[model samples]
Target: MNLQRRAVRQNVEKSRFELPVDGEVALADYVLRDGVMLFTHTETPPALQGRGIASALIEGALLSARQQGLKVRASCSFVVDYLARHPEFADLQG
Candidate 1:
C-alpha cells in the first residue's frame, strides 16, 4: 500500500502494452499517439485497491510524459480526477 514509483517498460511478456509501476499488483497506462498520450486504463489489484496505487501509477505516467515532452489526453477517469487535483501537472494535460 505504500505508493512507490516503479520502473517503466513496454512489457515484452504482455507484448501489447507498456507499464508504469511495473510489478505492482496492478498497473495503469497511457498510449502514446501523435505527440499526446491517452490514459486508457486504471487497474489496482484487489489487495492494492483503495491504497492509492492507481494514483501513483498515474503520477508515474505523468512524469514519464514530462520527460518525453508529451501532452496527456486523460481518457481514464482516475487520471482526469488526478489532473483536477494536481495543477502542477496542468502543463502536461491535454
Candidate 2:
C-alpha cells in the first residue's frame, strides 16, 4: 500500500498518532511526560493487519518525536521491536 509515503497525524487531545487506511485508522497511543514520549499501544484494524501500517505509523511517530526534540519510551511491544530493528532511531530512545 506504499505506506512509507503516507502521513501520520497527531491527535494531541487524544495523545495518539494516526494513520488513515482504507476507511480505518491505525493509531499509536502515547503519553508525554517531562521530555519523554511514552508509547503505550498500537493498533491497526483487523482488516488491515500485516500490511505494514503499524510500522509506518510508528516510523512517523518517531520521526515526529525527533523533530520535536523529544525522547522516547517505547512501552508498546511493537514499538520496542521496531526500535530494535531500526537502529537509526536508537538515539531517540529514552
Candidate 3:
C-alpha cells in the first residue's frame, strides 16, 4: 500500500484510519453527515486500544479535515475531547 489517509474509494478504504506500531494492523474511523462530516466514530481491534489507536485515528481525521478544508460538528465525544486537547486543530472543529 502507498500509505494513504484519503483512500475513500472502497467501503474499506477509509477517510480516517490508523496503522499502529508502524502498520502492524489497521483500524478505521468514519464521519457521517447529511451533507458534511458531522460525526466521527472509531473501532480499534481489541488489542490496539492500549496502544493509542483511537487517538491515532482521531488525529488522522482532524488532519484530513484540515487538508480538505472541512469543519467538524464533533458529535463523537472522542473527537470533542481530541479537539479540546489539540487547540491547534480547533479551527476545524465546531
Candidate 4:
C-alpha cells in the first residue's frame, strides 16, 4: 500500500488520528501538551491487522504533528518501533 497516499482523519475532539479502510477504522490515540504530541495507543480491527493500517495511521499522525510544529513522544510501542525503522521522523521526537 502507498502509505503516503493514505487519507487519515484527525478527530481533534477525540484526540485521535483515524484511518478508515474496508469499513474498519484504524486509529492512534494521543494527548497533546506543551507543544508535544504523546501517542498513547493504537488499534486496528482484528480483521484489519497486519495490513499496515496502524503504520499508515501513525505515519499520518506524525505528518500532522510535523505540520503543526509539534514534537512527538511515542508512548505506544508500535509507534516507538515505527519510529525506529523510519529515521525520517526522528527529528520530530522530543
Backbone clashes in candidate 3 total: 0
Cα shift from native, residue 26, model 3 (Å):
5.7
Per-residue lDDT of 24-73 in model 2, one digit per residue for the tens? 99999999999999999999899889888898999999999999999999
Please provide TM-scores, in order, for all candidate models, with all chains considered together: 0.76, 0.94, 0.64, 0.94
TM-score of candidate 1 versus the correct structure, residues matched by position: 0.76
TM-score, candidate number 4: 0.94
Q: Per-residue lDDT of 1-94 in model 1, one digit per residue for the tens?
A: 2236554344424421333343554566556679887877777777666767667667766787788798987777887899999999999977
At residue 49, what lDDT does model 3 achieve?
59
Q: List runs of model 1 lying over 4 Å from the truth.
A: 1-3, 6-24
| Per-residue alpha-carbon lDDT of candidate 4 for residues 1-94, written as tens digits (9 for 90 to 100) | 5643258989999999999888889899999999999999999999889877888888888999999999999889999999999999999999
Alpha-carbon lDDT of model 1: 0.67
lDDT of 4: 0.90
In the range 1-94, model 3's lDDT, one tens digit per residue, is 2233343221335655555544455444566555356655656666655766566666666666667677777656776787789888878765
Q: What local lDDT score does residue 3 receive in model 3, on the 0 to 100 scale? A: 37
- Candidate 4 regions with alpha-carbon error over 4 angstroms: 3-5
Per-model lDDT: 0.67, 0.91, 0.59, 0.90
* Candidate 2 TM-score to native: 0.94
